[model samples]
Target: MELENIRRRKQELLVEIQRLREELSEAMSEVEGLEANEGSKTLQRNRKMAMGRKKFNMDPKKGIQFLVENELLQNTPEEIARFLYKGEGLNKTAIGD
Candidate 1:
């Protein structure tokens, strides 16, 4: 009878251990998924300067002409901002008024 009880207890312990192992596996899977999501979010959040775009193929005279045409030297802070964000439809007179 004692040997039978020991065997029953051993079976119960094995079942508990198996349940714990399954729980551990599920927890590890969840952690891996969360880590993967974090990695993607980090990549999206960071803005890295694009590679191979730092150099421009232009003459110095052309660069100065372009700046002059844009009135870069005489532009106000707001005007420069407007030019920078031209797609946003900002009014030149809207600022400092």
Candidate 2:
């Protein structure tokens, strides 16, 4: 009786693990889809303007200091990221004004 119970529990754990693996596979595919679709027109324009460069060369600390001293930028990092990636208001709730 004890051996049968152990076998049953082991089978149950194997089934659960398989289900979790399938879920993880689906999630990874969704992430790949998002990455493939991330290149919008505005982003493509920005890439072209950079002349094949992958990343910016500016120092973030100095940039922040300049913005603060000149009062040129007012938004938070999250808000600025939304504007940059064009995902603004995507996750906003209806109750959020």
Candidate 3:
């Protein structure tokens, strides 16, 4: 009788251990997901802050002239404008002529 009771108790302990292991696995998955989400948010916030700090408000025409007068750029104004606005989805109208 005592042996039967010991076996039943062992079975119960095994079931409890399995339940704990499943709970731990789910908790670990949730932690990993939260960590990944936090990392992504941090990266986006950093990009936004960097972009906010780096402002290029120069007029394209004046910028081109300055570069040429300073001997800093050898390209023509048209070429410089094309280079600046290339792939930016902006047209010459945005530059006010």
Candidate 4:
């Protein structure tokens, strides 16, 4: 009786793992489909723009000092990100804004 119970529990665990794996597989497939359909060329352009944005040295310490001195730039990432997003069309949300 003990051996049978152990076997049954093992089988249940195997089934659970299989089901979870299938769910993950399906989710991945859906993501792939969405990625394929959602403006690939636009994405490529966005990637290039993002690469270029690295050159735009915001230099937090310097920027904050300048902002504090000039009273123009904001004090938070959210504010800075929104300004950049509107001005440059970059993704503020992706940067945790």
**Candidate numbers, best TM-score first, in rank order:** 3, 1, 2, 4
| Local accuracy of candidate 3 as per-residue lDDT tens digits, 1-97 | 9999999999999999999999999999999999999999888765543332222223445545554554444567675655456524323453554
TM-score of each: 0.49, 0.43, 0.55, 0.41
Whichever of 2 and 3 has more lDDT, that candidate is 3
Error of 2 at 85 (Å): 23
Model 1 pairs whose backbones collide: none
* Candidate 2 error regions (>4 Å): 40-97
| Residue 37 local lDDT, model 4 | 74
Write model 4 residue lDDT over 3-46, tens digit each, in one string.
99999999999999999999999999999988887878677656
Clashes of 4: 0
- Candidate 1 local distance difference test against the native: 0.50
Better model by lDDT: candidate 1 vs candidate 4: 4
For residues 1-97, write the lDDT of model 1, one tens digit per residue: 9999999999999999999999999999999999999998766433221110111012323433344453442336664454335523322343222
Segments in model 3 whose C-alpha atoms lie over 4 Å from true places: 56-97
lDDT of 2 by residue, 23-71 (tens): 9999999998888777675576554434211111243344334443444
Candidate 1 Cα deviation (angstroms), residue 62: 25
Worst 10 residues of 1 by lDDT: 48-57
